[model samples]
Target chain A: MSAEVVPLPARAPSLGPILSLTQTSMNAVNQIILDRMQSEIPLIPALAGHLIAGGGKRMRPMLTLAGAAVCGYQGTRHHRLAAAVEFIHTSTLLHDDVVDGSETRRGQSTANIVFGNPAAVLVGDFLFARAFELMVEDGSLRVLKILSSASAIIAQGEVDQLVAQRRIETSEDRYLHIIGSKTAALFAAASRIAAVVAETGDAEEQALDDYGRNLGIAFQLVDDAIDYDSTAAEMGKDKGDDFREGKMTLPVILAYARGSDEERQFWRDAIAGFRTEDEDLAHAVTLIRRHDAIDATRERARHFAERACDALSIFPESKARAAMIDAARFAVSRGY
Target chain B: MSAEVVPLPARAPSLGPILSLTQTSMNAVNQIILDRMQSEIPLIPALAGHLIAGGGKRMRPMLTLAGAAVCGYQGTRHHRLAAAVEFIHTSTLLHDDVVDGSETRRGQSTANIVFGNPAAVLVGDFLFARAFELMVEDGSLRVLKILSSASAIIAQGEVDQLVAQRRIETSEDRYLHIIGSKTAALFAAASRIAAVVAETGDAEEQALDDYGRNLGIAFQLVDDAIDYDSTAAEMGKDKGDDFREGKMTLPVILAYARGSDEERQFWRDAIAGFRTEDEDLAHAVTLIRRHDAIDATRERARHFAERACDALSIFPESKARAAMIDAARFAVSRGY
Candidate 1:
């Protein structure tokens, strides 16, 4: 007997499914965020609210909510933990702006630029401490460990990126390691804690962790790809911030490795901070395009995204699982 | 009954007693510090060690150890917690240098000046995270809440001070409130956690908190006074740093408040950043000394030191209690 072949329906990969899936829980998390970010010091909330109320996607906390939904967690504990996750992310963003001297973020003035670096730095610290307070209130040692370890990893990753800056010889392995620590570590922790709250078994926890971690890698890869992609829309960040800062993201790493001798000289000069003019950025984009490095980076992201989706295979089929799978695919499809 | 007043022994107050009281436990705390501050990132440890290994006196951690001793607690948990206290202090100091743009600290180039501001900021973050991780390992929700709350307060105090900077109208009350948060909050938490680890009752915890809190205020007051004392020995920090930073310390507040019209204008211009030359600093010192602001600040410190010692009266008399009392007295007596 001949086997019948089936064709699946095609649809655009969008964040709609996951966002809607977790919307109610997200509102609760947002409420927790607003309540906890408040301090007697007015500037704390004012400066934090500038970015928190700004057009952030709240992507990390969404992972926690969605992870909990996928795990069939009925309790409200994830709400506080998710808020904690968002606070940690926000704290890092504030400090990141200070470190990068970034003037704008999310189509608005960065806290560092608007409030000044000292305020930004101190407020970042306040938010970080607040994040810990939220976790402590949750009263889970496991959650505390997951989040605190991730925080240290994120800080180390930041320092690693700083050390790698202005050096053209940074490899893809090192780049991945940095992003894994700085970005994926938090993502993994945010998702894993959902299982902790749900009392899910070790296998299920690992599944969620793998899902979040791989998705984080995919998300960051696409972000780096978009930085060098000429056809990409404005990312609400300076179009060439990565190049200007001499950051060695995956696109640049691949482009440099695949370049001609003269092109290699250009990459070295650009990454060494010798070429920062607009025209120099344009030329860098051209070189990146010539080697199809953006496409290669996206391809790498696709690999991780597929892994992210496959990680949820251990779970029974449900709308939450399907939405999470779409979220991974959406991460890879971003900046198209 | 004849009440005989026994005059106190005519000996200079010193940190010697407290240092000896906590020496054994402090050694363990130091080991934990050296171990925990390390990371796979070489620069993390290198930059952190630059400040940690620098002669910081480890005063905050000593409070934790001494509080444990005063509580008659026999456990190693306080060792890790004490190290965590020191980490928090180190983290704040590193960020403080960046915020103040300080070039030197503890007789050495600051992490910010040596490794760069970005490194200092990121490394500060690493140590802060590491501090939480240590608390998590100790598995005390109470300690976590104490330290985390204190940390938030400390950050708020820092931002408040930043807002008050260069404002000539800052009152002593406001200055006291700022120092209470920025300096004493951690001290209170550090001492309180020892009671938590010892399972001491609430009364003992409150007493230790009061002791550390008052001592911290006294310590900071002396530090501020020493900055303006012409006869004071070099205290390993730049002598005129607070003046140049326009920090509204108690001495500055007192001097500015008590100045003549022309001297008030000088104070205004100096704080407003118009007067920053060495001679300007010299003139400012002269004005502070002329008003006896240093002595007044030290007198204020003495009040807090008395309260700090009195806070320990609830505990039975022991070497630990006497040493702690001496430590408080020494805090007020510094720079004599």
Candidate 2:
């Protein structure tokens, strides 16, 4: 598994405006998280910091801050909320690596691979618990509800994915449901909670939520596209990692539907056997390209990005709102 | 693993009262959950039912109903709340079995064993997601907050236990923290949510929450005790199951503190190897008994039971309250 680690290009294309906006929104909150994470509980701080500093895009936390900023939340709770979102996201990643038996993440060894499954799972739980503790301090039941519901949905989405594995008959609707629950739900919750915490009305709350949800969908579609397009080194792990795990992402599903009988047989054998041989990988890539799955997926992702921007149109135009829109666009276009 | 199956007794004296209460509660919420579980999504209902019907004490749900009844809740939401609690518990159990690698539960094969690990995990996630859907229907942000926090705490507790395993220096305080988070947190959440939904005062709500927490602690202490004293058949598991799994339960901790040099050596070897031979199990059992660890553990359980009862003193004295107290006592004294 360690042998499969692929180092991606150290630099993504410049996003100066988006980067500056996100950094400004997140800087204060990130510091607070750093301070609060210092704990008497032995080894917790060390483990948490290791994972937090592991070069995550901090997309969930950024969504949270962006939502709050867009809604004119002047208070400090947004920082805590953003931190809580990151903790939940990080915790899930820890458990996910264990479940998927992955060895590398972000060009580094996965926590489960480095610290063992027990440590990874436990640390994930610790982060989750700690996140709750932080939320409790905020004393907003509404925020708590949104975040909790998101956690449940995320867990369910993962489960749906698990059941869908190697299942050729899984519909696009089911696929949407899985991704919505697993990925978009958290993004939605992060944004929506900001509205809830700020006591925004239902209309604005729903709009921000829509923004986050569509952005999340776009993000995942881009991820699926990259899985087929990127080299192992560029992706920070093996090519066809999802395929090796028998995961049926959007591209594969689209390719399978559009491919010839021979292509379908290739999927059957590859997925059923959990095989990621060089030829199988090459064929999958070719099939995705041949069927225009990559282009279709990208188009769908852009549609979501547009939808996200549309959701933000209801809010009075402001720098924060513009930043939030840019963030969505960034999610769709960001390279690994 | 199949060869290790130990059939529990068809009947037990303690189970009579529990079964009666459980059956009554199930009848109330059974159809509701069944109806609500229906989905256009294939495999979800069957999987959800399999999980709900999977044998559990229904302790959390029972606590929810019992808490509401004691608080004089006249509405029907308690039934839904009960089902929600059950779903959360079942989801955790699904994940727990996978994490623990347990083959048997309630004298039957575990979901992970029967359905495979991936299915068990995913189905667990489904139940958790279903739980959120149910929670949103209540529209009480408080209930969502409680359940979500409980979920996070539960996950954290499991992680704490994982990290603490084989570390002989683990404190009783830490043990309490782990069990309270893993087990009592949800129990407390169930009852607290009942009080919240019933629109009770802070005092009564705190009382019920404390009651649930102490009861949960006592329940887990008894479970730990039985792991040492009860047979595989009696306990619905192999004797020394915890010891075999390298779990550092209260009995093992107490015994280790009191054991001779040789006995300590036995524990060190058992945890390291992940099993204890029959003779080693016998020796460990003898040391636990001789050191009065069983009685000490029982005493601790009783203390918590008393604390649970004490918390209910402020509640209007009624049959429901009496039953709640009896339930706590039964938790510790049932097998004895």
Candidate 3:
């Protein structure tokens, strides 16, 4: 009992490396985003600018730039493509707010809340069309194919998620499938397009896609986990949104599987939207913690993050590769 | 003394010629539409099919087919392109229903009402993405650019219309501009692409574009006129919707401009949404009729329809050309 207990100390993973690696190109991408979002209709730019200027991590665009760097690409083509990827992401976010009736995003008023749902929906359409316009201007049918297919997949994934909402029995596999399409498909496309612009052959393209896809899973899992982790810092989104919305995320899946009969009954009622009060959310967080569901979700995320890092082993070691690896680690480690 | 009015009756313009001209190829386009709309997600097809099979006239796709016939296109490329055009049109219709919160369309419950706004919005996104996927499969960047640009213009026009809603001072020029962007842009693109597939010269492309654009304006003006024309047959939509929603259509613009001081006050309150009862709509309709605004709107539509027919003067006389001119006349003559 008296034996010394030592806590293992490790430096926390950081996005700083990846951020620095892609800084200049990210600026160019940002410029393209700003330039392309403009229209003769003032409302289009006003509503779009609110979210565009809101502080997002710009993770998807960063992946494009970083993938281009890892591929030893010297062209400036990725800049516009990266902008297109961001536009696609932003469009989905706007629509998501309308679907969810969300009030806050990025710790600020959502576009749907700031500009009414009608404006939000229309501007989302404008941005999505603009994204395709950018891809067309780049004259890459290949990129267009990748992004358009991904867009369809993302929409299907959202509809599937809507169908699964408020159902307590959703499996972890189904949740993974939903996120794979809704979140990871675009990530994979974003990274793969960089490889295409760099003229990297199939192997490298596949490698980057694998990397981005796995990292996207890890990121989404952690996001779900953080929603139920009461001890975590506030995220850009409102906390407990998934719980209130009855989204069957991984932590809820794990907690439901591990809970006692009474706890299971509670989950069923809560997820069916019968229990949305503060106490219900608190009980949910407590039950999730008691069953170690948050830790389990983080464990799953760590596995994917490791796979994501190993995906780059096909390429030679470089600063870009190292930074990308670090970014994957950060994806799993954030809000811990 | 009595005036004997001999009603001049030319054979009422019919879509018969155009319909027969494109019937065979339209079947091919229909097959493509059915084949492409399917997905493993059952709801996508169920919701999409409800509207796709909901007895729409397939006007936009027909335009594509008719334009192809007019250009004497020998190949089947226009079939797939026509399906793509229909998908774009269907996607916009779905979104429009959601934006307008419409309960009925085509004499049936709207997709938004049956499937919920979330499903309608997501399915709309899916169809829009599918439209681009089709374009990508065709491997034509020029067509992609045309459609994408048109899509953006449509979105902007919708936003502008939303801004103009409930504003009594909206001008006829503004209304025309909005319709030009929202409705006519797609028609112009649908027609122009046929020329592209035919490898016709720039002049031919411009002529077809002019034909479709003017025809679309005529079609929409008639649509607006029909909304307030009580003597006309019930349309495939809820009558008085424009009045209830305070949309600034041409009839409303002309009526607002021509109303007496007292009548103007009634319009001011009605357009501001303070007056939505049945009697209020009745009074509004009476004012429009008293001012002959419905007839004025139809007269405007006729001018555009004549321009549409004249646009075909450059082409040699043929079955297709004659059918297209009749189609223009039909655009103005419907619901007279």
How well is each residue in B124-209 modelled by candidate 3, as lDDT tens digits? 99999999999999888999998999999999999999999999989999999999999999999999899988888899899999
Evaluated on chain A only, model 1 obtains a TM-score of 0.97
Docking class of 3: high
Each model's lDDT: 0.93, 0.78, 0.93
Please give the DockQ score of every candidate, comma-separated. 0.83, 0.28, 0.81
Q: What is the TM-score, restricted to chain A, for candidate 3?
A: 0.97
Lowest lDDT 10-mer window, candidate 2 chain A?
Answer: A10-19
Kindly provide the TM-score obtained by chain B of candidate 2 when compared with the true chain B: 0.90
Model 2 interface DockQ:
0.28
Worst 10 residues of 1 chain B by lDDT: B227-236
lDDT of 2 at B111: 72
Give the lDDT of residue A40 in candidate 3: 92
lDDT of 2 by residue, A139-246 (tens): 676776788668867876786787788887677778888899889999999889888877889998999899999989998988888888853228665567887888
